[model samples]
Target: MIPSILPTYNRAPLSFVKGEGVWLQTEDGRRYLDLGAGIAVNALGHANPDLVDALTTQANALWHVSNLYQIPAQQKLADALVERTFADTCFFTNSGTEAMELVVKMARKYWHDQGQPERTRILTFEGAFHGRSSAAIAAVGTEKMTKGFGPLLSGFTQLPWGDHEALREAAAQADVGAILIEPVQGEGGIRPVPDQCLKGLRDLCDDIGALLIFDEVQCGMGRTGKLFAHEWAGVTPDIMMVAKGIGGGFPLGAVLATEAAAACMVAGTHGSTYGGNPLACAVGAKVMEIVASEDFLDGVRARSGRLRQGLEGLVASHPEVFEGVRGTGLMLGLKCKGAPADLVQAGYAEGVLTVPAADNVVRLLPPLNIAEAEIDEALSRLDRVAARVGSDAG
Candidate 1:
């Protein structure tokens, strides 16, 4: 029976009442350690004081104002984004899919303004997950995402994941205006494209005069300990999309681009009513302040090392459940031999929350600011889950 809320998710039986730091409380008062961190959205963790303050302060002052009017908070957030990243311009959105849509438009229009309207093709790879929107579905036409959506949007070409030769040939082709890819694929079993490969792709795009777009929507905002995942490769894209942690749990996303790449996006070309709403921008700005600090990022790196070591230990201890662990910083994945969903259920029973992903991988996206003690507690819960899984298999 379909409930009014839409049965899209195979949701766990648990219903959380409230959250604080890296913990979620059930209505009946059981506390669960939140390793998922709302799929990497809660960078500062649930009900963060700074973000709460930012939201409430803005709510007291103002709420919704159309982009037609000058919004200082929005501008402030844009300035912060531009100052920290490679983008010369910023466009706000309510979610990652919307930001992705804006980027697609910007890329096609940039070539159009240059009188090369035929160059509208975008290159993506296999095992990529963009978003759920139409354009996004077409951008990443995985069978699971495109089953019902027929006659998918055109102009997107899917390349084999990690095939450098194929990528080179495709990049050399005409009508290829832009190349869109994720440096660290969040939904593709936590696969990270090698650093040398990113450098090669960047060089190839530069040679072919194609705009490079990095969908850092899942890997940005300190999820990888760096400001963006591409920072590890030291390659910057002409355009980038960021969401998730940028809002610290509030819905906020942004499309960032170089001035030359965005030159064609003039007035009346595109706009969003609630894209840069003061409320979203206010919280986003505070999140930026906290995540952009070197001290905080350094701490994230430390925690990542700790988690990696602990997971490696788990793999050794419970070879029946896990094979290995992968991913950078807080965006980790435990490669499971058993069903990932079953492991997630085990975690639920042990008072820990984890997310299941493709390739039998269970993801751990703990908040960037999670405490050391919480990390130990989460590991303890995972150890218990491992024992349960092993016992059941036996």
Candidate 2:
């Protein structure tokens, strides 16, 4: 029996001893195809050669250095991020939740610095999963995540997901300082915001002078066949939070913003001790080098089509089990008409791994460099799982 840890996670029974490429191995040596990719963190797959090399090299060198001194690796990673994206400035963090907290603070500070102290209300969409922190829970406001947590943070204003009129009206409020949204809602059920909706929000934010923020923690880092999900909509956010795939599973997150938007965060206004540590930055730099390549992104787009077609075929064969498939690129979700958790368990038993999300959706987050044959193999296992579950339901 496993040791009793905290009751935070309702974990599956299986645990892997090791992993490589798209396969995980149990201690007893049973192999399983990993489609969840550690909930979209392993962009380069488990035990990737480049990532292993970077981590080992950095481990031999310096590990921790306080933020008081200038770190070259941190500066290098920040420069690369700024060059490739709309962000003119970058602030590092240890996790996506921390990055989001910094973004909220930056948003409020922006208005305050501009002499509009009352412009502190931040508008967020319903069904959003910012994080688990107090500020994040307040921004998300989901009953499951916020039920026992008393007295939610004061500055957040929750709006319905994808409601244009409500969002516009909220933006028109003089007290509204910023609008935060996930370009693709991950935990809220892998829903991609319509491009037209994003464009409208950008126009509205511009008109009302409210900063637009995208929580790209789950959908960014080439997971959506692009470096950032907002690129598909052609609308740039004033501030964006990215994590999960940013470090290729090394616990790194960042808040990127245009200089003007981040100008409010002056010295000593906010900071983190291990935010830009050398080891995390070195690994992050290597991850960016590999993921930001044209060939890697092209392969991601090509493989995404393969996975989508296979899922579509699976849905066609087992319509009673699955309602449909949604989402873009590698961050796809299957809408399960039957029990999603049951299907996930069935997949695990069939030597495959999948993740369940809200709205009864099963998420498939394969590695960014997954081969076509691996996609076919995963689909075969999914087909078997679907057939078994469908027969049981019948």
Q: Which ten residues in a row have the lowest lDDT in candidate 1?
A: 1-10
The TM-score measured for candidate 2 stands at 0.98
- Model 1 / residue 233 / CA error / Å: 1.2
Q: For candidate 1, what is the lDDT?
A: 0.93
**Model 1 CA lDDT for position 207:** 91
TM-scores for all predictions: 0.99, 0.98
Alpha-carbon runs more than 4 Å astray in model 2: 1-4
Q: Look at candidate 1 and tell me the lDDT of residue 97.
A: 95
The lowest-lDDT stretch of 10 consecutive residues in candidate 2 is 1-10
How does each model score on lDDT?
Answer: 0.93, 0.93
